[model samples]
Target chain A: MGPLIPNEIITGQWDFVIALLIGGAFGFVLEASGFSSSRNIAGVFYGYNFVVLRVFFTGMIVAMVGLLYFSYMGWINIDLVFVLPTYLNSMLLGGFIMGLGFVIGGFCPGTSYTAAAIGKIDGMVFAGSTLIGIFLFAEFFPLFEGFYYANNLGNITIGEMFGLSNEVIAFAFVVIAIVAFYVTWLIEKRVRKNMTEYKFE
Target chain B: MNTNSSAKRKPNYLNPYFGGVLLGLLLLTTFFIAGRGLSASGAVKLSVVTVVNKIAPEHAANNSYYSKFIPEDGGSIMFNWLIFGAIGTFFGGMFSGVVYGRMGKLRIEHSPKISKRTRIIAAAVGGLLFGIGSQFGRGCSSGAALSGTAAFSFGGLLVMALMFGIGYVFAYFFRKLWI
Candidate 1:
């Protein structure tokens, strides 16, 4: 009954507009939460600040739990929602590359755009490099095409794989998030005490 | 001091927990309406497809990866939802910057220890790798890791865990860039 565009509940010219509106909210939240600053985002990896971890995991858990609840209440159809098909080998390899990129670049694609908007030259450079990297990948698509499509698991979910209900997985994430938030708070306090170069500003 | 005066006027960022709750609500809204979570990389891929179609339409049409993006009865790739979303992200970022008074002349942000040149080089390299990686993985952090994993997608969980795990593993080597 939902996913308005796909279901014809909302159609014609409004689809793009709705997408923009949602994206605007997404960007505003990221920037306002200090994601526009590379230092702020990088702080999660360092023990100085755990804001990234808190926001990211909290958002994930909330969305997960919310979906499960919505399905239970018969408000939304879970079957209609899109799930990215599992390509185990490529996902692992790709994630490793992205991890390296995150540490070196100091900005993800979304955050880099926000950082660029706020006049960060590094952010602009990163954005440019992303375009170039995509171009390069396209040029050599033949080389990695096999690996990219390898080990397809047909949009499987963790619940299905692990024999657990979606609710249980969501609950476990909530618990994990709470523990992470608490642990990181302690770590941040300890790390900030020794730091000489960085400040909250 | 002059610095102290400037610092006093600078807007304070939203508290992390508060921001997280708000973001979580936003994510929830997205699922309810769109039946999916948020994504960022798809827009970038759309941009790539559009560019390729323009310069080498034939080649782009032939490539399995690029062709998937171009509609069979093609008109303009710029009309995609993801492209519009990205434009909105730019505006949203600008709006936030305006409210916070963070808008100003462009400059490279880096740790005091690193030179601007070093920071730029690293950023470019990192972005290049991410570009290629996202294609292979079928998504990036926002698309695959966050949204997919939130839906309990196996591939999504794998990417999220591995990406963060690898980030921590390699973070120490890049300590000077940030810490």
Candidate 2:
């Protein structure tokens, strides 16, 4: 009964308006959480801070649980919601490359924009180069087109892949995330004590 | 280090878990209303499509990837909701920055040992790589790694795992840039 837009319960210009509002909230939370700082983001890898991992995992678990609950309560129709399609080889390679970028750049597309908005020159540079990178991909699409389309898994969920219930998978994920949080907290404390150069700004 | 003024002026960030919870709620609300999660890189793809179509109408129409996004009716590709959402992200970030007193003159962020020029180049190159990678991966951090994992998509999980995993794998090599 929910997913008002796809179900036509909400239509036309108002849809885009709501999208803007949602995006606003998304961006606001990101910036307010210190995502506007490149140093904060890079801290996850260095062990001086684990803000990125904590925020990301918490958000994922919370949303996942919220969706399952909403569907169970019949407040929303989960089937109508969009699930990102899978392209295995492309994603694995792409993710690897992006990971390298994250370490070097200290920002992702979304976070970089937020940082740029707050006047971080590095953030602005990263954001600008993204457009160029995208353009390059489009320009050279023919070369890797086959690789991109390889191993099409077609809208599969992890629950289905592992033959687990969504609830079960979600539970497992929550447990893993909590453990990670605790481990990272200890690591961060230790690292910060030894870190003399960078202050958690 | 101007500790007194810095401490007095700089607003403390919201607790990370609280911020994540707020973000999750926002994400959930989006699904409830729009039936989709938040995305950042998808919007950039649209921007790329729009720009290519404008600069070379023929070229955009000719490409396999670009043509997929080009409207049959020849409308603007920029009309997508993701673009609007991204614009909102910029404004929202700005608003938050102002509230937190984080807004300031443009400055390149880097480690003390690194030259500003080196950091800028690294950021640009890193961004370039991420942009291309997102196209291949179908999304970036928010769309693929975060939202996808939430939806329990295997690709999402894989991307999230591989991205962070590989980052750790290679972090030491790039430690100079950060640490």
Candidate 3:
């Protein structure tokens, strides 16, 4: 009844059209939320603006809870949904490198694209660099080929990792996110009071 | 540049909580309809493969990396879902910009302390790291971290934590670029 494309409830060019619409929603939400600004994004770290933390955690928890409800209602087969495969060491190393990039560059791949779309030169440069980085990785594929495929944990979920049900974990996340949001709001107030260099744009 | 300074004082963005709810619902809809969440880096990867395939057909054919994306059907790699999603992202961003009056004018954003040249250099270097990292991590923030965490994937959680954790650790070092 759901996952219309995979379930054959809908077929053909419709999926492509849906992809565009979904992508649009994704982009609009991101840009309208002030994600197009590097300063706004960087503020999450400095505690001046907590928009990134708020939006990111909220989005993740909402989807997590929604998936549970959908599965419970049998509206969609949860098993059919794509769960990203985990490769421990590879992701750890990759995530670390990306973290450095985020602090320095001020945009992730998705956010940067949205930034670039609105005529931000910095966003455009970041996007172009991402291409160069990918090309470099491909060019040096032979060197890291072994490491990339190492630590293959296959498709695993946090529920499996923690031996808890998805609903329980999601509920826990909701609680954690609320606490974090409250704490960050407090921190942002304090940090903004002392800041003379950066202000919300 | 000065015209932009006068064109708009500031953009009125939506409330974070409201925007989050909308984003969350969109993500939920994606899972319900497509059996997956959103992504961005995958499109970039595809474009890289396409370029390599075209520029050096022989090298791409012989290489272990580029060859994987070279379709046996000789179809366009850019026709995939992620690429289309990215294309939509462009339009969606523009739509929001126009509506919010945030569009029009290009500028290199950076701290007043840093020159435009320095800002561009830092951004490019940062972007390159992200690009290479995504390949290793299997996705970037949107794909691997955000979507992955939503789906309750272990790898997603790991990437999210480590990425943010490292960002905080290194943020101090790169403070000048932003602050």
Interface RMSD, one decimal, each candidate: 1.4, 1.2, 1.1
Off by over 4 Å in 3: B1-10
| Per-chain TM-score, chain A, candidate 1 | 0.97
Best by DockQ: 2
Give the TM-score of chain A, superposed on the true chain A, for all candidates in the order listed.
0.97, 0.98, 0.98
Candidate 3 lands at a TM-score of 0.96
lDDT at B95, model 3: 92
Kindly list the per-residue Cα lDDT of model 2 for residues B1-179, writing each as its tens digit. 26996576445788999998998888888888988788898888889989889899999998988998988997879988999999989889989999988888988878897999999999999899999988887899999999888988899898888889888999999999888
* Candidate 1 TM-score, C-alpha based: 0.96
lDDT of 3 by residue, A1-201 (tens): 777778998888888899999999999999999999888998887788899999999999989999889888989898988999998889999999999999989999999988999999999999999999999999999998889889898999999999998988899999999999999999998997897666467
Runs of candidate 1 exceeding 4 Å displacement: B1-11
Model 2 local distance difference test score = 0.89
Best by lDDT: 3
Could you tell me how far off, in angstroms, the CA of residue A75 lies in candidate 3 after the best superposition? 0.7
lDDT of 3 by residue, B92-125 (tens): 9889988988897998878788999998998898
Q: Taking the tens digit of each residue's C-alpha lDDT, what string does model 1 give over A1-201?
A: 665555678888888888899889988988998888878878888888787898889889878888888888887788888888898888989889988888888788888888898898998888788888888888888887888888889989988989998888899999999999999999998998898667665
Which of the two candidates, 1 or 2, achieves a greater DockQ against the reference?
A: 2
Classified by CAPRI criteria, candidate 2 counts as medium
Fnat values, one per model, are 0.75, 0.79, 0.82
RMSD of each: 2.3, 2.0, 3.2
